[model samples]
Target: MPASTPRPVGASGPELHDHLTCVAAPATWLSPPDGRLAGGPGGLYVADRRVLSRLVVTLDGAEPEPRDAETLGADRVRFTAARGALAVERVRTVRHDGGTERITMRNDGDGIATVTFEVTAAADLAQISDVKAGDPPPPETPLRDGAVLTGPDGYEVRLEGRTEAALVLAPGDRFTTTLTVRAAPPPVPGFRPAPPDGPPPWARTPLTVRSADPRLDALVAQGVADLGALLLADEGDLYCAAGSPWYLTLFGRDALWAARLALPLGHEPAAGTLRTLARHQGTGHDPVTEEEPGKIPHELRPAYAPGRLPPVYYGSVDATALFVVTLAEAWHWGMPAEEVEALLPAAERALAWLGTFEEFVSYRGSAERLPNQGWKDSSDGIQHLDGTCATPPIALSEVQAYAYQAAMLGADLLEAYGRDGDRHRSWARGLAARFRARFWLEEGYPAIALDGTGAPVDGLASNAGHLLGTGLLDRDEEARVARRLGELNSGWGLRTLTAEAAGYDPLSYHRGSVWPHDTAIAMLGLSRTGHREQAAELARGLIAVAPAFGHRLPELFGGQARRDGAAPVPYPPACRPQAWSAAVSPALVTVLFGLHRDATTGQVSATPLPGFGPMTVTGVRAGGRTLTFTTEDGAPASD
Candidate 1:
């Protein structure tokens, strides 16, 4: 095996570990005899800290241990141990694979054993791996609840040239393969190596972004810069990572979504995400292309043989049109009209996809799914309690609006560029008209329709969040929408759903947590439509309370109702410094500052707030050129 491919592409190889290796035992727990690592639905785990680094193995008569460990794509675990003159390195790679691990020996040394690995899964995962001893690794063990069926072929090495047969395991505990095994007779030094360096955790709270907290600021800046470096760019545009451990690469929707603000902060690398996502724009509805003639791609990568997720995933109902959405927003921030013009076909095709998505994505039962395509796209994401989700023939509610808004904008861009102006405007007008007629609910307001089936997946879900931000809802409707949101937007911020709704749960990830970024979008939407009081109320409340959190707003927090002493509950497992988490704050600034740039003529406007005085944002670029803005100290009449 090639030495490069031996260890996994992004694995902790023979070196000082990066961010993924190190683990912190609570300062309270004295180091146990051996750290325990197990594999389960949660993913890979570690037992001992810095216990094992490189596990080398050699047959009794073999020369030296093979330095290369074969690559196992999915989940796996390993332990390092030595028996007699021979050394054993055990590993378990599970498929939806599961199990427990056990090791015993009779040989020259007496010491400890260690293991390392992580579990990767889409969602409903449950598996564990640990050390054990028996004829078989014990299937009935609670540790074996998710044990693998028919594990890998077992290998047995006599302990005292003793013991029975070797047990089989998955990357499952597939229990951690013991690192070093010891027999009674005598003692040789057992493997006691350092752990790999893992990604550092956020500074002990009080994380700040300004120089006043210089030490912590440098740390935060590095975190910010690393996230920036992680951007996988194509051509000139960039895509953001929501891909996670596996696909943490670029994603079309991720790019455009994050790009909405990337450029504003002088994030130049994001330019690559912009250009790349646009280049793969759809041109026709070949199931393979998911490409509807001109829709921008949802994913971009090389080596995607014909029909693979590498180059495309039509599963997303909004990426393409949003590609145009980002294009327009980019121009608004000073990228060139020519650049916008360049993506014209992509924009037009994206507009075309508005109808196509309804046609193909109707979960009515069309195609299986594509990864990283939708918000709920973990493997079991499509389905509810039932096995199968509505299906591609199904049209989700928010997607409908995303399509409408993205299409309408694409058309507006077309008209602005003087390219098929009449046709584009007509399409834009038609979509607006259609959206009002079809999506608006008579009783439940906009019935949060799951699709054309007239199914109401109704809730005051944050799903309706984009509605306000996009300017898709007009003044009259915006008022109604704002009024409706009051119930969901408690003092803290907008809840994912109203507490009264069935889908609502203060702790539910999608059901009702208060996502700061999501709340910010809703706030911007309210502010956009001149709902100043409502927007300001939200911003002030959120900003005022957020600093209690050390000024770095986390991705989200529990949306539970507030009493006096309750500290906002941080979303349990949210990633800090997430691409959008950082970006949203700036958008909040823009909303608060009332900053708007007209890409067409390159005019910058700043309407300061009552207490807020002159604000200057230098190196501000729009239409592909940089410009500066200075406001007089005096507040404008409105401000």
Candidate 2:
């Protein structure tokens, strides 16, 4: 198998693991991991555009040597450095409107200090994609306050800051300089934008976990913090952005899955996510964006340039299905009846779209759409077993599973809410029968997808693992899928492609990478199917790998096996605080604890799996009540 594909024309490696400190707030930006905004890949990003590209600080013609850097929280970073007799500390806070960076210079020597303090700042007004591709930014004008950069159309980058011409300080004295950047002028003089509001209502729903293992505690704490920070509000509703630097915007499939996995936290977040997507549901046909009436959008972001992405794009083949599935899950998890009823129309639309297009969801874009519109959106993501790209209008196997679950679950929700769903129920039965006949292979697994001509594109992949417990597979099929997934497991997590497959690349974005959320999905399915031991093993891999990445799971990592006791290899350029990525921790905890609810009976329970360490999880809210669970000596108990 080829280790890497030739870089696509005009496409470069997405620096997923860019060593930078990202502060996401009213606006978002990246700086050197040491918290230095001294230019480079670290720049201020607002509305998916780079505002300030190069910012450097100098003292007497010398740059400070960074000594230490630490991310204080999701929206704050601090760095310490020194140059000659001056010690410098930089504190950066990302706020709702812009950012406030405070630089403190202290004189350490026992003499008066006089040195020039020059801050060279410029904005390149580049699109985030251009920046990621290493394209040159436009020319910038150095205004007296700062510099302004221009981009295509009327987009503008207004950089504003001030530095004293010279700093004079006595021994032990400190001089502080404040720099601010904004898309618009600050509301008041010296007004520092406040931090984002406290955690959402669902986040406050009393979910807590404590264990003797410090790693477990850290994972839970950081997961909560990161999820809270990733949440974005629109018209009083909340949904998480996909990730930093590249995708800090609404993504239909990503947000849907994240919200579903977060059900253990509270249903309100999921409810808001469902409603938000419904509000933006595609209302008409637009081939440019692949938008069709009733289709859920693949992404929603500020319009940067023509032909890039319209403010909204509805190209995803599975997000529409996943939307109905999430709504159904939320309703069953105890979302209010009125809220669920309000979204019934949107659910009907998504369900109708699911069946109207040739009994399969296919992307409309052949040349213009994202190469692969599913979660694996990278070009050349879907492939036949021979390393050739799967032709367009492809039907991914996992998407069929999503559609099956959506149809059945949507039927349940519609019936429960006194709506006519007989068509959905009947359609689901037919799709499942067709799927079983067409998708299952004699090799004891399912194909990766059905090609444009409806022939099975044979490949052993982790996609089949998502079929577990979705009602599309029988007992025998689920067992085969479970066993096949075990073979694909690198002993750390599930690999997207088996090693024997033709296009396998352990480090590739989709072919053979291990995505945390993907593993979490399969793990949840396994647990639901009564495969506790297998589920436990899957959860263990994620726990074992968490500490390697600061206990914060990244979007995906290399699929190198856990042999000879070597740690899992990292995927360079993966997003660290990715929404679905951070969401895996909670999802894993939910699965291991058997955290599920029965709203019809008003019961919430957890069945602790074996081999897990002694721990107590308190304040878990479900079904309008808070519950606690504890495990000791491999036994489970709850309150």
Top candidate (TM-score): 2
List model 2 lDDT by residue over 242-359, tens digit each.
8776777788899999998888777877887888889889889888878888999888765442236666788788999999999988888888888889999999999999988656
Give one clash count per candidate, in the order shown: 79, 6
- TM-score: model 2 vs. ground truth: 0.91
Compared with the true structure, the alpha-carbon lDDT of candidate 1 equals: 0.45
Cα error, residue 495 of model 2, in Å, equals: 1.1
Per-residue CA lDDT of model 1 for 106-185, tens digit only, reads: 22234332222222111111111111110112232111122222212221111111112343322222222232211111
Q: Which ten residues in a row have the lowest lDDT in candidate 2?
A: 185-194
Best candidate according to lDDT: 2
Off by over 4 Å in 1: 1-230, 243-247, 266-270, 283-292, 299-312, 355-392, 450-452, 469-471, 541-554, 611-619, 623-639
